[model samples]
Target chain A: MLRALSVIVICGTAAMASSQSNPPNETRSSPATVVPQQQTPTKSTAIIGLDGVKEKTAGTLNVKDGKLCFVHSRNKSQISAAAIADVVTGEDSQRVIRGTLGTLSMFAPYESGRAISMLRSKIDILTIQYRDDDGGLHGVIFTMPVGAAEPIKQELITQGAHTTIQTAAVAARGKQ
Target chain B: MTNFFRITMCSCLFAMLSLAGPHLHAQRKDTEKIKASALKVEMIQSDQIAVPAAFQVAVYENLIQQLGKKASFLHVYRDGDRDAASIPNLVVLHTTVSRFKEGSEEMRQVTTVAGATSITIHCRFTSADGKLLLEKDVNGKVRFFGDNRKATYDFAKRASAVVSDKFSANGQS
Candidate 1:
């Protein structure tokens, strides 16, 4: 009976891990294809340091008229693309479904809740470095749906924003 | 019957050990406290390495946020604030990034073992008169989960732990 229960738990855990292993939207595509303009505004969570919105606020972001704009509720704020100093894209993960269910699952019996809570959903990060009018440096971070960051970055670059890494070959040469 | 009894005994022992783990950890912290008054965090220096601008800002902002939560200082001062100059008992914290490695979040999530981001910082605490108080090489990393920026948060937490273990705002050393 004990061995049977162990096998069941193991299989359940494996299933959960495999199911969320790769987010469906993100794919390993070549850089050239990653740069096409995405017209539709992307839904995102502002993690930290956006000017008007509170931290962790959910919002829609888009590039409009040479600016990157974030809108939450009735309030909106934007930074001109030319003022942006750097655009850095990163990868991250959080507990599945924003962690509320995971938090409640801690009360589950037999320590099985611990395994369930460990499951996570992959996320993409976009960190923007900009300078204000007086030349003071600032940064804002936003987490978006999988596969959303690169296109946004490409759009920003097309609109005159800068990135530290110019190209893959240039980055490799610098490393060497 | 004997085998059942042994298994039950082992389970109880395991339970007892798990319960005692946190209690023992707290006792160790009690012995590591030091006394101080105020702390000023200087801007992070990365002259040796070409850190990304966003990363530099992230590290600086996260450290300031974490230091405010620590009880080790009565006052936390930012870089270039005129107010910190007046605090006679202030200890200045200087941080320089010694090493950094950027890792892919996608690689880590897909493979679970391949991509891990790590950073090493040299932290120095000095008195107003320039005497070194405490210095250590602090490291932060995200091995299996989270963003590359989470490494900055991890570094901040560990550095705060070192400060809490060595300094206190309530009294003099």
Candidate 2:
């Protein structure tokens, strides 16, 4: 009886040890799962610069062949670097859309009729500010919508005549 | 004899468990990594040198509609000649934000994420002689949706509204 009991104990110990050691096939499959994840690229390469701006893990910024490039989080489309002509910075800084003066005039008038009359008479500079997706800003030059170029020029000249383009950061700080 | 057999079996089982444990952990880590990678933003643009006029018109129209009353005025000039004009209280600038249809596959394949996502234009408004005026970067994110053109438009619209408010207040100065 003593010998039989001893054998039974040994068998139980061996069974417990086996059960604890093997774990599950799923567990063994972890390495395979990990390898692929490690290989996947997370973000696109894009560069962005601005004040009070923090880098999010969504996309990336980079310069390719002297052109700035940014990849979106989802579809990963390829765009020409030249599409971005320039980057403007400041509080109210904006990206100027490349379009005709007529199109831009449609959205924002150069000034009141009086201002227009002056613009038509002489060269009147109209400044338009815009922003891009990367939180950068830009400005563009155009004529006043109204016909008065001279008076508008005079007014601008009196008002320092030069458009004070402020970076979005500076504009935001109310410095411009 | 039985004792020896039991000890050997226990050791082998323990070794197997140890190996499997790390593999499972590593798998979980890998999955987490992939999920993290998929959550980033990218920038992209068109390859064509000259964008079509129709496309440009559409973009301009879309921008005007979005700006509504904020656009003080809008004017389109073809090759430095005035083509169209409008008076809006505000203006907004935007950049194309796009996402890859196949996630980051393009980036992985070409290793050249080229215009996958980015800010292409630096919009600025200045005096005729290039005097600094007002400017901002039209930056945004791309999501899993239709073409990114709409996304860009939407961004422009929202940004324009914000800029209009600021301009109106500052114009008093």
Give the DockQ (2 decimals) of all models.
0.07, 0.01
Query: What proportion of the true contacts does each candidate reproduce?
Result: 0.06, 0.00
Which numbered prediction scores highest in lDDT against the true structure?
1
Candidate 2 wrong stretches, greater than 4 Å? A1-176, B1-58, B72-120
Report the error of model 1 at residue A4, Å. Answer: 7.6
Worst 10 residues of 2 chain A by lDDT: A114-123
Q: Write the per-residue lDDT of candidate 2 for residues A109-146, one digit (tens) a residue.
A: 22221111111111122322233444333233222212
Residues B54-134, candidate 2: write the lDDT tens digits: 223224434444554444433322221121123222222323422222122112212323323322333443333334445
lDDT of 1 by residue, B82-153 (tens): 677778779889999999998865466546687799989999999978899889999889997566778898
Flag regions of model 1 displaced more than 4 Å. A1-10, A22-28, A167-176, B1-57, B66-94, B99-119, B124-151, B157-173
lDDT (Cα, tens digit) per residue for candidate 1, span A114-157: 55644767777888877777554567888897778878887887
lDDT, candidate 2, equals 0.33
